[model samples]
Target: MRILMAGVSGFLGTRLVDLLVADGHQVTRLVRRPPRGPHERQWTPSAAQLDPALVAEADAVVNLAGAGVGDRRWTDQYKQLIRSSRVDATSTLAITIAGLSEADRPEVLLNASAIGWYGNTGDRVVEEDAPPGEGFLADVARVWEAATRPAEDAGVRVVRLRTGLPLHRDGGLLKPQLLPFKLGIAGRLGSGRQWIPWISMSDWLRAVMFLLARADLSGPVNLVGPAPVTNAEFTRELARQLRRPAIIPIPGLALKAVLGGFAQEALTSTRVLPGVLNRAAFSFRLPDLPTALHAALHD
Candidate 1:
């Protein structure tokens, strides 16, 4: 399959590109800068500038474009950047796809979203069908997902990937914690009761490919493991894997001081379930926390 992708330099995007290439799929990346290689095409999403022929030539378009939510302190300005980065990239692609004739349009659009949509669910289990929740991330997610409306209305199959925490030692949620865990200083956040919906890096890549091929599936799909664990359970399992003790808990106040607005999201409990994938009978390679964490650290 010929796949056109945006945000190819990101954590998930980088790995996904490698996996797709390994699987013999032709992948072209959309870049804001000048093209560095034949596989890259230049486009300024902020200005809605892109070649329509690029969209028309591809079999599918996968957009993973967005500013890193936790990359910086969430000042008012940074918050706006987070929202604009996603909405601009998505709107650009969706609008471009919508402009194409039916014969020229790509068959499917796999857009990036987040489980943050179901914000602060506490103990309530949320699936893809759950309505948008309250909070900054949730509000951003709502607008982010809605940006794909143009493509959807154009009859393109749209899959909004409401991704959870993908565990990997190289990046995502596990990288920063590894050093502290190895030093035996890591612990849970707040009361450690917050439910964390996590998936292995392997499963996340595989799931994207699965959804890319599944013609019958569209709309929001939760890319999470079958089993969800609390913050304390995750802390214990991670420490056990590293042969370290996790007893010193980090207070939420400390997190707030360090992470700024992102702290609230870090402590937010989102017990997301992969209802769409489960219904489609998609198998997870690492379905449990222990197995997933081990793979993240060791593999």
Candidate 2:
């Protein structure tokens, strides 16, 4: 399949692109820079400008464009940026695809979303059918996923990937926590009871490929592991892996002071389950937290 992807330069995107290319799929990246090679195409999502020809030629379009949620303090302006980066890119792609003739339009569009859509799930095990939760990230995800309406209305099978916390060695949620946890200065965030839905980078990639191959699936698909662990459980497992004592607990106030609005997300308990994936019998390579941690650190 010839897949046109946005966010190819991002951490997850970089890995996904490599996997796609390795599997012999024709991958064209929509880059902001000038076209540097045959695999690159120039486009500016903020301007809503992408050549329709590019959209028409692809078998599928996977949009993973968004500003890093945890990269900086979430001020009002940064929050708007986070929302716009996703909604704008998705809207641009959806509109471009919608304008294409039926014969030329791609069969499917996989748009990136997040489990933050469910906000703080507490102890509730929520799935794709759950309504949007309250908070900033939830609102952003609602608008972000809604931006794909144009493509869906155009008869395109659109899948919104409500991704969980992906563990990876070099980058992602695991990397930042490694140094602090290794130093034994970090422990569970807040009460340590907030349930965290996590997945390994390998499982994330594989599940994405699985979703692309399954024509019958569409709409919101929770890209998470079957088992969801609490924040305390996560801390223990992480510490155990690193052979460090994790006894220091960061207070909620401290997290809020440092992470701003994103700190609330840290204290959030989203016990998510991949209902769609499980129903479809999609298997995860690293289904458990300990295994996922080991793979992220050693694999």
TM-score of 2: 0.99
Ten-residue segment with the worst summed lDDT in candidate 1?
Answer: 177-186
**Clashes in predicted model 2:** 0
Alpha-carbon deviation at 288 in model 2, angstroms: 0.8
Worst 10 residues of 2 by lDDT: 166-175
**Alpha-carbon deviation at 64 in model 1, angstroms:** 0.3
For model 2, name the residue pairs that clash: none
Per-residue CA lDDT of model 1 for 236-299, tens digit only, reads 9999889999999999999999999999999999999999999999999999998998899888
Q: Work out the TM-score per prediction.
A: 0.99, 0.99
Off by over 4 Å in 2: none
Model 1 scores what on Cα lDDT? Answer: 0.96
